[model samples]
Target chain A: MSDAETTIPRPSLGRLFWVFLVMGATSLGGGVVAYLRTGLVVRQRWLDDVTFVELLSISQTLPGLNATNMSILVGDRLRGGMGALVATLGMCLPGASLMIAAGFLYGAGGDGPWSKAFLHGIAAGAVGLILVVLVQLGAKTLKTFADYVFVVVTAVAVAFFKVPVPYALIAAGIVAIWWHRPRDKDVR
Target chain B: MKQLWDLAGVFAYLSLLTIGGGMAAFPEMKELTVDTYHWVTFPELLHFYSLGQLAPGPNMMMVASIGVTVAHIPGALVALVAFFLPTGLLTFFVGRLWTHLATWRWRPAIQTGLGSVAVGLVLAGAIIMGRGAITQVFFGVIALAVFLLLWRTKINPAYPIVASGLIGMALHYFNIA
Candidate 1:
């Protein structure tokens, strides 16, 4: 890793921000991960696939949006605290501005019947998108029958019983972790 | 004044619930913003969320929309900062420590365990969003078509999603929906 780091020229903070900003502005739809890969690995040659996947795993496990988390991690890796700051800012800026503008338009009576119909249709479509994401995530994460059980139990508790997320996350997380606890025999 | 504080506190708390992805936090987000604080109606929340999909960056940038609706620019800033800061710091520090924990015996267990739970959270969120989004058979057909198209192809999602909105407009034009 150190060898690879030494070989690739580290990007200045401005360039770092620019790279992430372009990705932020271009990653339409929801698959920001793919955009990050193309920008970092294919375009910039900043990180190889292995490192990208490693950072991505950490991003996934943490409690934040993957795009911003990746920005932070990759930024910190390249240029320390300042890099993380700039990268995250760049990644979020375009979207934040657009959504804020959307809020204003919405406040100014943008929700006419026609717009409402459009929003309703998009809302339904977004459900389909989220379902696709859910299916893909399940395929990658779930393996054993017990894993599927955890998924089902957690979903039911939250959706049907109206359990608060914190409580549900903790309860399910603890039990799931215990079930997968390290064993001596498995250490090999 | 109080609303700014409320927005900060709500978004900050909501940010931590986005374990696997932004969608994982959707249900709780709907609860606080709509049911609890009355920041937006349920349908409005759905609209902002759906619009967020077309936005360029993170999927949950709709938080800023909620913030804007509540208190304009300041509200948006506070919500954005609060939403990103705590978890951002956590990721920054934990990401550094992650390399050291690479050899930790329980690492794989934690990863595997959390992966399942994360999927569950996302599933829960999907169910809740579906309840609001799929109000009619026409909408259901749209959703199914989008799902199948995206699932089966490499085409960009923006095309189909945009088409869905246009289909919606057409339905409205004809008074079909």
Candidate 2:
């Protein structure tokens, strides 16, 4: 059958490997920042703003690995189930293999000068990249005054308040859900 | 194996909490697996956390690593399935519903509200990231400058990441923290 004919078959393992590799290679600093990088397909090519924004939204909202969500979105767009499977696996494998290797290498000794230096540059550079993500994403979503306030408040709450992660998440989630829940337009 | 099943249960639980993805869930995972369960020690968990960080596919990768460490291949399988299946089903269903519901005016309001929530979640994520990465003032400054540069530069993600690594090396050579 031609490639288009298949709707949701299991993806070929080899193709999945490449997809995994691409995601793996790009996510250098780790998961915290990699989504911004892997988002290039939407940012640089193929997808448009509204569509890309929507994809990102779905990816972020979903509970699975963000990278996997991204990959599945990309994969389903390209080929179908096989593609998604490939993408998810592709996105995941690098970290898995790398971790295993690192596990083997764990406690090998102290950090070498180069490793330390490399990590330092990464640590610094990652901040810049993450900052960029925050701004760009913010611009897309934060049009109103309320949004602006939310961002400011949340940043302070976490960075300074040092509220534990789960509580912060729950608290913010409650606020947003309640804030957005359908209200009587006339009442407002 | 019993170990695999246990990993599955943990991953399943963790997946439900990933409202904003891995970073959103990191602290929770760190607490449950690292502190509460003591399945992995803090420092050891940190290493796997690093692997989860640099791993290519998804931040949830720590599940597989965690599983593997806990119980070999089956452990990995349990963790993977536990983490993935529930979330995938839920997301796909939610996506369908979200699209169907997009016609509502209140959708925009809801989105706006969620946007705020995302900010809060990410803010929390950044704090977690910061506590780990920022050991001293020099590193802290680097993070700040880098955040600004990303906003202004429109540079490819790779460039910044690579530059950071190189920058890390430079700091080491110069004896800068």
Superposing all C-alpha atoms, what RMSD in Å does each candidate have to the true structure? 1.2, 5.3
Per-model lDDT: 0.93, 0.61
Per-prediction fnat: 0.85, 0.59
Poorest stretch of ten by lDDT in candidate 1 chain A: A1-10
Chain B TM-score (each prediction, in order): 0.98, 0.76
lDDT of 2 by residue, B49-152 (tens): 54454455465566776776676666666777788878866765565466777677666666667666665556565566566667778777777776766666
Q: Could you tell me the lDDT of residue B77 within candidate 2?
A: 65
Scoring model 2 with DockQ, what do you get? 0.44
Weakest ten-residue segment in model 2 chain A by summed lDDT: A29-38
lDDT of 1 by residue, B1-177 (tens): 999999999999989999889999998998999999999999999999999999999988999999999999999999999999999999999999999999998888889899999999999999999999898899999999999999999888888888899999999999998
Each candidate's DockQ score against the native complex? 0.89, 0.44
Instruction: Give lDDT tens digits, candidate 1, residues A56-75.
Output: 99999999999999999999
Residue A68, model 2: Cα distance from true site in angstroms: 1.8
